[model samples]
Target: MNTSQEQAEQLFAQSSSEMQADHFDTAEALLVKALNMDPRLAEAHANLAWLLDRRGSVSEAVRHYELAIELQPDNARIHLNFGATLAELKFFHAAEAAYHKALLVDPTLPGTWCNLGALLAQNGRDDEAETMLGKALALDPAHVAAHFNLACLLLRKGRFEEGWHHLEFRDWYHPAEERLRCRRWKGQSLQDRVVLVMCEAGFGDMIQFCRYVAVLRAQGAAQVDVLSHPDLKPLLQTLDGVGDVFAMDDDTSASDWDYWVPVMSLPLYSGTRLDAIPAVIPYLQAPADRLVYWRQKIDQLSPRPGLRVGLVWHGNPAFENDAQRSLPSVQTLAPLWRVPGVQFFSLQKGNGEREVKRFQATQPMTDLAPDLKGFADTAAAIEQLDLVISVDTAVAHLAAALGKPCWLLLPAFMTDWRWLEERTDSPWYPQVMRLWRQPTGNDWAPVVAQVQAALQAWAQPVKPAN
Candidate 1:
């Protein structure tokens, strides 16, 4: 090779090694020096783009990736990286174009296909997403990420079996192998083992999967212990078959449990079906004293008995689609305001004060949430209310678990596992909850209108007995 080419190759090798070591700053510096020596070095530009993307400088990464693509237009891997960066920046259309370009350059690139599938899924094109993901899996069956992503898509489409089948790939995606290892109990017989069921993921997921505890016990688990968030311990302990309950943060290594199953997988292992779902309501009960206190508080508010509605118009701000799924202010629920004799109480928490203030200005509403210190208080308040009108949030799950009626407002493209494509009822919450879905992408008006109609029906007074 020529002297300049030889020097460029050496610098590229050194920078690649540094990148692998995660010395991102050092790798970026080396890649820059190599690019200066040889402007046509496609690898250096791609490597620099990768380092910049990792550092969260997505715009800068995009510029470098575009330059690299210009230099080596046929490089499928560079196109994949560029597309992924664009997706991170929420440039979905551009990202889709980049993925398509990559596929055109090299149709058999399974990774690029998977990236394209994810972009399509995010953009609410599930059918196209599924097709691309299937293509990816056909190219490489054991591709764990493709399997996992495909499972998510299927779950969103309400295809439980396929979704769960693909979900089995989660263990492969974990960075640490130890995190994937299921706790096993060695027993003289299968019936003799004490199984500890640990809850992971979001609170809603834990609530949804907690339905399977009774099923696990039926499978002959001698004792079923539960390790979950501290907030859930008080309520979960009341569920049948839950022998012992401990906080997740608590040191459970010292506890004597033979086997452990992550909550969600219990359904898969036990071969649970939707119809066979244990429809036991009020599995979680509030403490009597707390319930009494909330009842007295509600009495003081003098809320009418016909339709005592609890309102939660917002969810956690950190949630990915919180801006779309959750309203910024309770005033957005103006339809509910017009429903006569329907009393409203705020069940929201954390940055919900502004929304409460907005509601007070426009509607005659009570703020019960300020005194609600934790999930325990929230549970107590929910027990007192006739019905809960909430966005897709932990509070809705809490209300449903306690056997209270809940009106859940869902986004067009909701969380994968809710799985109600266009239905008004949830298989997860059974009789205690009703669903109102958005008509189009992120539009809450139609859903709110539906909830208003439901509220009007609920608010009609009955005749008095002689």
Candidate 2:
């Protein structure tokens, strides 16, 4: 008869194989059986936690991680896993302590160094993050997360040359889209060549980087086609120098294009520098008919409103970083309601649209989201607004592309790479944007107060500053 320890080891080996084959359900069952046989099996608990985390049972995973750490106090890997779970839960300081402890237990672990470095970078500790990431790279030269983290740190510091170079390693983290089979564009001659530029990331990223379509044309590309989300097709068609906007689901052959490039790579290939950003205003246009329709709708709804201000309080909740990037709710935006004579239009979409009704009784705002079909409709509605005040979302990008004034609300931590660091103005939208940053630990009161003051000033009649 096999001893309990020997039987548990066999079960664990079988579970490892199941997990490697992507049979998560079987793997989980086996892990549970193994843990029952050997209650003190720390590795079994750790493996189960990883599977649970992947399956979105984060709270359960955290419990398992805690149990694993308790069973094996000196296991550096378990500590590292515990740190990752804590970070995911937004327990930043505790996560840092866990990472530090893991490093102390095993100074040679490159991954621990990389995770600690990335955590530091997210919290805005640049110098120490650089040192930690550098140490990770020294230990394992090909560590992708270390390279990506270092790239972001450099970019934040305005070291574009080195940053872009390091950014090329992002493919290791997320490989470039493989559907398009064509030669990749590398800033060489585009004369008489047809280049397909793909929108590889989020909606905001697409809007921000699609300006490069016009830049590609200026570089003598004969035809510039775009493969992007279907929702953007209507609006992208209006962008300058774009020819034949294709939906991402299109089964078109790449044989038609001489080369292709990911949209995110455009800034790097365009040789963009901080001082020389392609800051041309009004690169996108709303449909004339839609613009007229929205204008009429707003006029009939609020016949003699003083200032029409559009507000977006939340972004897509499914986004991984939504905890840091998104706001609590429209309820937190009460300060904006206090600014008299300013008519608030709810430009918020998704599940958050219901939030408007919650405030409508007391706040008295117009909800424009129900009639808005897609980005084209949103763009048209934005054109009619006096100003757009939004949390970081596609609407802000839409306002920027339309060359309309926008007040962009940013979180104190994990603001996007495009926003860079510190200054109020954005290089991408220079003349048409203002930024309001949240304080650390998810505080939005200060940012809302700033916006309230600015809105009051904007609503007033023209007066020269002394």
Candidate 3:
């Protein structure tokens, strides 16, 4: 016969194993059972809280975290995990306080220092962030997260030299892609060489970085091919100096290439600096037929025609930071419809499409999404529009890449590293873009108000887009 506490310990260990095996429900049940036998099982409460956080039961997770802290006040890891959850929720100050508490409990924990540094960096505290991250590295030189966090901070501050050097330690590439057969290009001579530019991260990342292909051509590469998401093939195929555009699922022969490099690494090899960013316009183009087709469709659908403006209110919901990056709904952008002489076109699909339909009774906006299949069609529709107004999604990147006037709405927190620190203009897009940032945490109304004011100004006969 085993003691009740011993039984609870066994269940706790079993729950951890179940979680490792991806049996989330089973693990949760075992954790609950363990806590039933021994209510003071702090580890079980902490693990259960982490599971709740993953499933978005944030209130319950917070309760569990608080209880776990009550049960085990000295548990540095519990405090650390709680901080990570708070950070993800964009509760920045609370997360920072939790991290500090963890550091006080155990100053030796490198992840606490690393997490605190990353949270600080997200909120524009670069100097303090660097110090915290440096302390993490000092405690343990091989800390990967500290190295990567510092890299992003440096990159955000336009300290490209040190940023790129530390970026080499960053590790989020597909293993198979990393082991490609061809020699990796490292700023070597591209004269008469056939090189492959492999897609690295996200849709927006690919679109933003694909400008590197032109840079390679300028460097004397004879033939440069690209591998990217299937949806981008139609648009990227139209790029100048690109030999072939194919999907990762398509047949690719490794022996035909002289050198291959990840699309992102191009800047490192090309020796890009703050003053030397390549912003040549019209790097991407829609097919001539599709462009004509979309223009005719737009001419028909937009009944109250004036200045054509494309609107994208949302992005992929699966993104970890989607809660911070994406809007609440298409209705959230209802203020834009009030702008006179501007024809609104809905470019949103998937997650928030219902909100587009919800506005049918009150508005005369054109729904262009159902007809848009992939990026190529989206690009075609965008080319037909005079200006594009979008959130920080791939559509914004596409519009900017097309050399069209784009107004980008930026979130207040976890504002991506690529945007750099607070200037209203983007160097990557140069003359064709404007950035409107939120005045404070997660409040987009004032930002939208600013855009509404600007839109009213833009509608003046003097500044017509066409």
The lDDT values for all models are 0.79, 0.87, 0.88
Error of 1 at 44 (Å): 5.7
**How many angstroms is residue 427 displaced in model 1 relative to the true structure, after the best TM-score fit?**
1.5
- The lDDT, on a scale of 0 to 1, for candidate 2 is 0.87
TM-score of each: 0.84, 0.93, 0.93
Write the residue-wise lDDT of candidate 2 on 1-466 in tens digits: 4599899999999999999999999999999999999978999999999999988899999999889999998999999988988888779999999999998889888888998888888888888999999999999988888888898888877888778767767662134466666788888899999999988768998998899999999999999999888999889999888898989777776448988888878888999887878878899999777888988888887777489889898888887677667778888888888888888899989958998887678775889999999998999999888899998998999998899999999988788777888879898898899888876768998988988898988787787989
Evaluate model 1: give its TM-score: 0.84
Query: Candidate 2, which segments miss by more than 4 Å at Cα?
Result: 1-3, 55-59, 172-176, 462-466
For candidate 1, the 10 contiguous residues with the lowest summed lDDT are: 172-181
Candidates by lDDT, descending order: 3, 2, 1
Residue 161's lDDT in candidate 1: 68
Question: Residue 89 error for model 3, in Å?
Answer: 3.6
Error of 1 at 108 (Å): 4.4
- Give lDDT: candidate 1, residue 195: 79
Candidate 3 least-lDDT 10 residues: 170-179
List model 3 lDDT by residue over 338-405, tens digit each.
98899888888787777778878876578899999999899999988888988889999999999889
Cα lDDT tens digits for candidate 1, 324-373: 77875777887788999877888878856666776467786889877987
- Give the per-residue Cα lDDT of candidate 1 at 322: 82
